[model samples]
Target: MLQLIEEIVYQVTGKNGLTYDTDFVQDLALNSFDVMNIIGKFEDHFDTTIPTRDVWHLHQVKDVIDYLAGRGFTQP
Candidate 1:
């Protein structure tokens, strides 16, 4: 899931070399619109709409996996 998020970040920022440590807003220069688009893709990919309150809590790749797991998306 982290890898998939990396891919989506790459696609969104048009940055081919994005890594897990890459900061979404700093390293990637992602704005609010880009964030929304990425979140949309994530919802579509996981078939779950993440709650808005949890959106601001995402700060890294692992956060996404944790959020999905918290939502019961536990596919290994």
Candidate 2:
């Protein structure tokens, strides 16, 4: 799941070498538009919808993993 998240982020940011500790905004310098794009990709990839308000709560790669886990997403 982390791998897939990393790929999705990379596909949008074109930045690699991400860790679970990587901060989407602080580390990657992602702006709101970029963030929304990433979240959109995540939704499409996982086939689930994420509330816009909740996207703000996902600050790190680990946060994304946990959110998906809560949704019962267990695959990479």
Question: Best candidate, lDDT-wise?
Answer: 2
Looking at model 2, which ten-residue stretch has the lowest summed lDDT? Answer: 1-10
lDDT of 2 by residue, 1-76 (tens): 7789878978998987889999988998999999999989988987889999999999998998898889899887
Tens-digit lDDT track of model 1 for 1-76: 6667777777776765655566667676778888888898888877878877788777666677777888887663
What candidate 1 gets wrong by more than 4 Å, as runs, is none
Report each candidate's C-alpha RMSD, comma-separated, in the order given.
Answer: 2.1, 0.8
- Judge candidate 1 against the unseen true structure and give its global Cα lDDT, from 0 to 1: 0.74
- In candidate 1, which residue pairs clash? none
For model 2 the local lDDT of residue 35 reads 93
Model 2, residue 5: distance off in Å is 0.9
**For this target, which candidate reaches the highest TM-score against the unseen true structure?**
2
TM-score of 2: 0.94
Candidate 2, position 39, lDDT: 83
